[model samples]
Target: MARNGRSERGATIIDVARRAGVSAMTVSRVINGRSSVRPETRAAVERAIEALAYTPNTAARSLVRSAELRIGIIYSNPSAAFMSEFLTGIYEEASSTGARLVLLKGEGGRPPAQAALKRFRKSALSGVILAPPLGETRSVLSAVRSWELPVAAIGAYDVDGVACVRIDDRSAAFEMTRHLLDLGHRKIGFVLGNPDQTASAERMAGFYAAIREVGGVEVKVAQGDFSYASGLVAGEQLLGGDERPTAIFASNDDMAAAIVSVAHRRHLDVPSELTVAGFDDTSAAVTLWPPLTTVHQPLRRLAAEALAAVTAAASAGSTVATCRAKILDHSIVKRESLAAPLGGADARSDPDA
Candidate 1:
């Protein structure tokens, strides 16, 4: 009798088990690279697998391994919009890896580092992924060291012994600033990012570098915390001044959107009376009436890469002692929010101009 389509495809675990004179579970364990199976049983299963041409589904095999491995993610960033995208990336990769992700919540009244340590110690986490602010702190890295587990830092500064995956914040910021300068924007205003995160400092440095490169320009800066609320305050401060800038470059999209709102209330037409640009081409950038001109940071891909690094390190155990860093590229996305200042920024030096 001819075989059906399903059976004709290839040999299944059941066939391999029968050939090896073992149960399906035993064959599965052998196929999944489990170390607990008896040597003789494993040998028999291997012979059966080879003879029957049995091939395991890669995803199913990952699922089997994941059933045993658990990973933890620690974060302290205050931006809800940013964190949402960040977490989604981690979760997707974890699922693909066949590993369970444990979100380690606060423990005791201690800081994020201590809380992460407590939760990590209590759980069976094979590895840890540290998000910004938390990842940038030396104390947190020290705490992570005590655990001796594989550690990966995403969107954090490169440390000596921890794997890191990030985009060049300084370079991205530099390009965005240069883009604004190219559009005849000299008196450009800036809104700062979160002070606790290292990326904030890098971004500020980039902005300054761009300003120095074009010495004949004027610049103003307002402190912001990478939140919509902080952006609003920063926007008011920058726009309310008598020597207001013709262009504003916020460190993040939320703040840039807030600047647009401020410009609207002030009866200034965006890109005509004022031009705005931001970093992190996040969702809020496009949702605005006039889409923002910004830098595209691949946050999701960065998280996925970070998770892969940590998981690989975890699986490798002590053999992988050295830290590794992966730097991804970013691009400047032009949109309706930016344009050459009316006439020229130098020509509109007067506050009302």
Candidate 2:
């Protein structure tokens, strides 16, 4: 309602511009979070926005700038569950804002940014969200940097000029490892994530740090590509060994679920014969036979936040480098899959030595 006391249905951007004594275009820029707006002018527009209680109409905004607000997501990740949750977040946010999201991928496993660039050139997308492996690729990042559109990468590792939204993968893995250690499991086998992503190294470092802190723990390691199949292979190697570990920690839920399946095939009772834990508490974590004791990573929230940054940059005519990272918290989620070693079997020697 107007301060002059006539009945008002809603305040519009034109009303805000009139109140702020600026052009409608300038008000639009301010409303969109553009970096180019002068300080005093921005403040004036903000004040007018607050005074008039103006809220941009989503329908009208979409009608006006639909062509300029297209978003692209480039990914080369192998996890189906992770991608489903990620895309859900992006779609929810994009739909709310009347923005469109376009899925893109590399051809013949080429650099993702190359495919992204082609899509951008063809349709002039406003920005892009790059998922893991693709997000961490140096060539892909460099290619994206050559364009004017903003880029937001998902995961803890940062690119030179891209905004990121992620949980601390290393710390989360450390917490999970420490949990297993505290549970009296010393002979622990570690399954690594995909080597192409920096997160693999970070998670491995965290696991090693925990082992080092608690001296004299025997450790076995296996490599995985963050897939169920790779986990099956890694599981066979670790479990088929002469001296199997009391517990296994896989880098992701899919891999850990595979470990559980392998245990079943070997007639080993989970948490009785072996304990397994995983990272990323995706749906597979809960759906597993015993449910997974894993790190609770907020995948959907990470995606939503990443998309928010990308959209903000698109609307504001700003680069992603100007936006700061949005780092989120993670925690260890305990389930039936983890427990103390049975009857002191394969337990560490000397309780407090």
Candidate 3:
């Protein structure tokens, strides 16, 4: 039966469940994706939805009246290059879903990008996606959890009330480190992300794991705040050693590029003399001096998933949950900057071995 618009009552939730051959609660949860539901069952529910001609009544006054929504995308980083790309992806995703994107770069006259974290409580948002320091900070997580608003973290942080949508930093870091090992690099150095960032901790775990797995290499690491300056500080440390790391893997491309600058200062040719690699595959990765071999983070997809979550959640008002945290995969891209430690970095390298 084709029901007309406006006054016509859409099919009830029970009808959808009946057609889908599942309980109404299952139908609700499948739509929500909050609790665990079988994939085939979820697909079947979706098909049943189409068959039942179901359309959510978001415009209904009662549905909209449950709770007012203010979605916030909060961050603590303000570096121009990395910050810009991250914000751009976030804005693109959030804006598309009709959620207002509050920059939350910090209020008051703060010195740098980090102070913004303190203001998340004051901001008017029902749901928030925290970036970096905000995503990982214990204080920030405490403040956010206290707010009782739904939050999706962009990295790996185990806050009780928060959900995470991020790559497995340990595995990604391990794989990247193994790549360098395959290139016959023994003295590999790592530049870590901000000490407070959980991803940094996980990434370090992976970096250490790679070194341990291969054995016979001196382990070394330097600290960075995931910024160009942080990279500079860490890069100098990487290069200053008497027995320098044959390859350096900075936590992110910004640091990697900074290390490239360090290499230039020492007149060491890239890849051939000293290889470098990074993560996040930001645009700056491509623009680097020989470019960088790095991990491809799916920022756009991540943002969209966050947006979809917030959008569905906000639209759900206070009627239980309508959406949840989603996971996505990252890839690795091999560019010019990473080659061999005087040898090649291909299958002949046998990273798994």
In terms of TM-score, how similar is model 2 to the real structure?
Answer: 0.80
Superposition error at 32 for model 3 (Å)? 13
Model 1 lDDT on a 0 to 1 scale: 0.78
Residues 1-353 of candidate 3 have per-residue lDDT tens digits of: 76695237667555676687754445656765645678888888899888878876645524444444466776657345666676777778655444676656543212224345456556667577777667666666666666666676676555555556677788888899888887788778899887777788888999998888775676678988788888989988889978887799989888999999999999999989898999888887988689999987876666655544544444544322222334578777899998777655432333554
Task: Count clashing residue pairs in model 1.
Answer: 1
Number of the top lDDT candidate: 2
> Over the stretch 1-353, how does candidate 2's per-residue lDDT look in tens digits?
34553235477655676699864546766877868689999999999989988877777667547555777888776776777888888888777667788787666445555655665556667788888777788777777777767888898475667777788888888888988888888889999998887889999989998888887788999999988889999999899988899999999998999999999999999988899999888988988789999999888888877776776656545555234557788988999998888866346664762
Clash tally, candidates in order: 1, 0, 0
Q: Which runs of model 1 end up more than 4 angstroms from their true locations? A: 1-67, 105-116, 319-322, 344-353
Model 1 per-residue lDDT tens digits across residues 79-150 = 666777888888887787677787854433124756547766688777788887667777777887778887
State in Å the error of residue 36, model 1.
Answer: 31
Spell out the clash pairs found in candidate 1: 66-98
Error of 1 at 232 (Å): 1.1
Output the worst ten-in-a-row residue range by lDDT, candidate 3: 316-325
- The lDDT ranking, best first, is 2, 1, 3
Per-candidate Cα lDDT values, in order, are: 0.78, 0.80, 0.71
TM-score: model 3 vs. ground truth: 0.77
Residue 62 lDDT (model 1): 61
| Candidate 1: Cα lDDT at 136 | 76
